[model samples]
Target: MSDDPLPFLDGPWRLSMGLRRLEPDDWLRVDDAHDAQMRLRDRLLAERRAEVAAALPGSEAGCAETLALLLEFLPERFPERWTRDGQVMVDRRNGRRVALDGEPPLVIAGRLVQEDLCLMRKGPDGYELSAAVLCFPSHWRLAEKLGRPMAGIHAPVPAFGERLGPTVDRFMAGLDADRPVWRVNWSITETDELFLPGDRAQRAFDPAEPVGSGLFLRLERQTLRRLPQSGDILFTIHTSVRPLGDAIVRPDHAAALAARIREMPERMSRYKGFHLMGMPLLAWLDRLAAAQVRVAAPG
Candidate 1:
């Protein structure tokens, strides 16, 4: 019930007035996925309630009672924000079961489908958040906030420089202090792992040899450290690097920036062995070089 949705959509309070349209097929597919997730979530909730009930068989901790407790507890903790009742139901707009409401501190209902925590704010362009960690909780505080219990969960130590790839670091290093950089997260992988290592993978870039310009980025070195054995090779693009600069970027400039970043995956894939890890350095160089090109070009 935090009145501050500021953390989620940075800057002043404003609504996302734009209506995003989705095709019927897209809607159906999203709805199916949402439904499946909700079913599983409800099942998990029921099991938890039953477990609590069994612990206190004839006591007040019955199945229905525990659910009531959860509902009651959330509202009490959140006060006016977290109200009970069916008013706050799952959204079925795109055939997905995400939570929806128009009030401040938007209510979102999603299980930990991916790892990584990111915050996005509305801009002249649209809503943008980290594509990588958008699916997963980056830190424990966020996980707890979303009711994702991670207690007693032994997390492996993070690998070295999990923040940003070498290329990104170099980009930041090249920026002038006066440049207004926007700390934004860009999505790279669909399901984790830097590269699929073969042509058969469902990559974001074109499959043509000598990889063409695309948004995908692949690293060949030990660019990532402390990766978990069980989970996918999820990475963090890091918040430190300023992906955007002031200068009132025109649409063309924005598109150019986006395309340059997208093409990183392809160029990065060409490297082998140690060269692969350090390959991101090339990506960084490419972005900086492109920015220079844009500035020097005659309008």
Candidate 2:
């Protein structure tokens, strides 16, 4: 079990190229919550299949190429639960039952519901989002972001250019397909629901509202790689959600998260939807910290 809880928020926020080389084994995580999470994924895919999954003509080649690579990569990486046969990859565990035929983006996108898939291609306008299957979006819409460049994609984030614009642009430009890079981002969500899209999707973190105080930390393990054959970027977002209460079971999480949340600047708070519940969220974290101390005391 990983010790780090709320990994992106467990430390002081900093502006830097905080990326790492991703190993084969770390590509996907199918945990104890696999069945329940997959049910939700299946439901979303069934209900909004056409809406959630689509791609432009420019992205078709990359999507097919990406699917081929994933089919090869998964079985080779997790031999116990996954296996590849010709152009198809089968989940030996029968977990993510997906047909390998049909649209390349849909087949690849439906590989795992917990993970959202996006493809970017370098056009006259630099890298643009050519295709995406974003089933578990945090608080944004795929329709709004489709075909948009990095700047338009991050328009909601205040002063993003000064903070992360230049750094991310350079990172993507230099990203290598052979050696993929990965990073983590975390946010506190009021609901445990995985597939929250559109403007109403941002989770509130107020203690005043009992419904919003559950505090399931949403973490996205995002990976970036430029496809060797297509020269397109393949970005995968694998989301993991765990109750804050459960996370505090591992030592130091509560105190660290409390400090980190309290120190968030105004621009960040607004973008993360923390302005509505930042104080209440901090208070709740403090209570969790006190409970931890009480449990550890000599009794």
Best by lDDT: 2
Worst 10 contiguous positions by lDDT, candidate 2: 1-10
Off by over 4 Å in 2: 1-5, 8-10, 15-17, 85-88, 95-97, 105-109, 200-213, 290-299
Give one digit per residue, the lDDT tens place, for model 2 in 154-237.
Answer: 878777777788777877788887888788887877777777775644545545664233667777888888899999998888
Model 2 TM: 0.86
Candidate 1 lDDT: 0.27
lDDT of 1 at 179: 32
Per-residue lDDT of 172-215 in model 1, one digit per residue for the tens? 23433223232232222222332122322332332332212222
- Cand. 2 Cα-lDDT: 0.72
